[model samples]
Target: MTITGRCYCGELTYCIESEPIMKGNCHCRECQYFSGGHPNAFLVMSDSTFQYTKGKPKTFTRSDLEKPRTREFCGNCGTHICTKSEFRPGAIVLKAGTLDDMSLFDKPDMAIFTIDKQPFHHLDADVPSYERMKP
Candidate 1:
């Protein structure tokens, strides 16, 4: 199934040509920062199936981290689009908020990095939770 999405400003857009391999919520500290103090909902898909359909995204990777995931965002709107990591090679994590049809992401299959989860972060009781990255 093909999925389409764009940034808040519509400056950067993308198309996903395949169904997501995994749907999950990340409560990592970094994700909290990116999502404005909440867990980040995302879908993992084959990198080959994802591509930009519009303007290029500005990328950022923390040099301080030994293993840093690269975040791609709209340079104009600063809307984080997707993330790439060497640890999860061949997969790309797309932010759920960027989806043109948000309904497609009804629920997360799992929640990761719960160690950093705050009391205010509401996690679905039915969803599996991990203290750290799923391994």
Candidate 2:
């Protein structure tokens, strides 16, 4: 299936031509901070499937952590597009909220980093929860 998405300012747009390999909700501290303090829905697609159809996205790499993650966003609107990390090579993590059609992807298969998840935030009981990350 093909997936299309763009940043808020429309400066950055991308298309994933292959089916995603993973889908999840992340509640890591970094995710919370980046998403303005809430879990972020994500779809992990093969790097080969991703293509930047519009302006190139600006990236900021987080080096302070054990596994440095790279966040790619639109320079104009500051809308985060995706994240990359050594933990999952040859893959790109799409911020589900940026998707042009939310239903384009399947429901999250899991919820990760529940240890740092906000207690007030409700989670899907049907999806398995991981204290840190799914192994």
What lDDT would each prediction earn against the true structure?
Answer: 0.94, 0.89
State the lDDT of candidate 2 residue by residue for 53-135, as single tens digits.
99998999866777788999999999999988898899999999899999966688999999998986678889999999897
Against the true structure, what is each candidate's TM-score?
0.97, 0.94
RMSD of each: 0.8, 1.2
RMSD (Cα, Å) of model 2: 1.2
Instruction: Please give the range of 10 consecutive residues that has the lowest summed lDDT in model 1.
Output: 43-52
lDDT of 1 by residue, 17-126 (tens): 88988899999998999999999999998888788999999999999999999999999999999999998899999999999999888899999999999999998999
Deviating ranges (above 4 Å) for candidate 2: none
Model 1 segments more than 4 A misplaced: none
Candidate with maximal lDDT: 1
